[model samples]
Target: MASSSKWTASDIPAQSGRIAIVTGANTGLGLATAKALAGHGAHVVLAVRDTEKGKRAADEITAEHPDATVTLQSLDLGSLRSVRAAAEALKAEFPRIDLLINNAGVMYPPKQTTEDGFELAFGTNHLGHFALTGLLLENLLPVPGSRVVTVSSVGHRIQAAIHFDDLQWERSYSRVGAYGQSKLANLLFTYELQRRLDAAETIAVAAHPGLSNTELMRHLHLPSAFNPLIGLVAQSPAMGALPTLRAATDPGVRGGQYYGPGGLGETRGYPKLVGSSSQSHDLDLARRLWTVSEELTGVTFPVG
Candidate 1:
């Protein structure tokens, strides 16, 4: 994987007439991704938690790309009902969606349960998107060449797959461990979704923004000053967005492909084709996790 991240927004394919949905688009990586997609001519849907913040982000994008059609829709990724409603609204409003970028996520936080009662990180980051994809399957499948891009994290290396026995962390839970589990679920969902997409000839891919300065760290106890060090090493939100854009728009991208930075240790660099961990790519685990996700979310993706 060479430095594919070297490509700038100019490198993105023109996206006229395409519709896209980006979760958690009010700030951080999600906002940057939606802005870039719309900048390239896609009509972007910003699925956000805070309408006010979403408006601010949407305003900024519109100011930058006057032609950028960004719509703000309320979403609480922690709640399955909200995910369903957002997807339903999109389905009724849009004839088709060419791209769905599952980019919103929560980082480490104190032990908490979602509206659905699942662990917060796992619930918001994985199950939420999992259910959203299911709800949007009909519209997504209608468009030929459509793509679903799920974002995971390098922290996926910390956990191979979730412990099924503690899917909700009923027994015991640690913040970092839960975070790792959620990230690992992202990979499993990506791999499994890719498998199903390929089997049904649908398109699904996965990516990760190397490292970036985003509010994703707000959940961390780190001081604001440490963010500068992160910025020094991390890529800008636009830079971090390359992998996602590539996954969504690159014509040559194949199902199951994963993209990330090409720099040293994949910490920061231009986006490029990158290899996932052996565990992240495990087929057996992906299959099992898919069933678990479906059962937990009570929404099976309409892959066929």
Candidate 2:
């Protein structure tokens, strides 16, 4: 990897002929990621919940890069049925997948459950991605240099716990705490998935944007007075997306490794290798989460 102090999107390797599927590609970090990949040479798929919005995003990519090959596929990460349907459609259309970027997420929303009755944050942020990845693993496993890049968050270190006893947050809930657990789960899932893919061609890596200004934060519901403060500190979506882009494209990135901003407190800066909370490294915890996730989603990885 290049020095963390200076790495940028220009460092991305040529992606000619690669097939990349990025979730939540309609806006924010996901949009920035899709644009970068499509601008390079990859055939990009914008997997989103809203086809109309997805079409607009695809159009935007093509407008920016006339030769960019972009397509839209409906995917609602909050629903297992939607995930399965999208995965099946993707498999039938494309046998080889070079990249799967799990970037869509919900943050700090009013307490609610997914269509499957999972806590909104945990369901959309972790379980949905988990099932989608498992269903799509076969398509990526056979392709050399393929990767699964999951987007975690710094929130994982902030009051985050598995809460296995109340994974659904059914008894009590703190929006911030619930979001933290979901982010932590993202890391647990990535690490365990990488372990399973250790002998396969595909690799699993994780990244975090570190406080970018984007639509994902709409649910924050902060006072209008704080908007300017947030704008001053938050980086652009393109800047926030560097860590993810690097994780997805950097050849030096290894399985189970994580990338994030290099700035102080990792709030905003260029991409670099970063560390996660100690709780994220518990092998036993990861295994347990993996088993429970399989039971919850009813989606199992092909790997043992």
Candidate 3:
């Protein structure tokens, strides 16, 4: 029994002839998002770091949808070299990208840096996607209804803000704070991108999967005593992926709009239009971050 009032994956419109690229599509919410789109008739390309896992994911999609068109492409978000290579491959293969879902990310992890010498969380979650989208912007510009959907999280509300002085967290770091900064960057990226794409047919949007059981939390550390309690409260990855699916497919969704769980505290439920923190909407901060991101990634967008 499906409730029309509640927007589920089934609510996604026909995606025939559409081409979607989902990052980190080898597992969890990314996999779920890829599956839904493939099921809806889109040609989905799983952009992942591990080609072996990516092939497995593509096989899984085809196993379920015999007629599905699924492909796997290598993408290591932690490295700018990989980002550029992946973008080149995608551009060579697909003339127009209908949906670019930046759904891959890292959560709380020990202090680390990407190959490009950026804080790991911010590098992969923000800068990586930033570079990818910019490099692929030319392909998306000609396609009507094309979108860039960046997946954020409720964690963005936690001690989050761009620390320009220490963008890489080189001075000091708290895993939680760094993770929140990355998530906040996701929204700021979206808002700034949308503003730049205002006159273009393409748009940029953001989404957050509430606390869902996913491998993305592998870095989370808690006392053994609390593991069971946390598991009991977490939502399924399928439900967690709804906001992303909605943000990607909803007809009424406007550029810069955000989607998330509709339940209390936005922990878990069906997807719906949601609001972000005031800090996430700070135009000055977004602009500055965008500029810094361009300089760091060496990728300039088609938009002004």
Instruction: Write down the lDDT that model 2 would get.
Output: 0.95
TM-score, prediction 2: 0.98
Question: What is the TM-score of each predicted model, taking all chains together?
Answer: 0.94, 0.98, 0.98
Candidates 2 and 3: which is better by lDDT?
Answer: 2
In model 3, what are the clashing residue pairs, if there are any?
none
Give one digit per residue, the lDDT tens place, for model 2 in 1-304: 3675888888888899999999999999999999999999999999999999999999999999999999999999999999999999999999999999999999899999999999999999999999999999999999999999999999999889999999999999999999999999999999999988878999999999999999988998889999999999999999999999999998888999999999969999999899999999999999999999999999999996
Report the lDDT of model 3 for residue 49. 98
Indicate the residue-level lDDT of 113 in model 3.
97
lDDT of 1 by residue, 1-304 (tens): 2235475567778898989999988887888889988898999999998999999999999999997898988999999989888888888898788888999998888899999899999999999999999888778886888888999888888644577888778888777888988988887888888777765535888888887778777777878788678768877888888888788888778988888877878777777888877887778888888888889889987773
lDDT of each: 0.84, 0.95, 0.94
Superposed Cα deviation of residue 181, candidate 3 (Å): 0.7
In angstroms, give how far residue 112 of model 3 lies from its true place: 0.7
Worst 10 residues of 3 by lDDT: 1-10
Model 3, stretches more than 4 Å misplaced? 1-5
Residue runs of model 2 more than 4 Å from their true location after superposition: 1-3
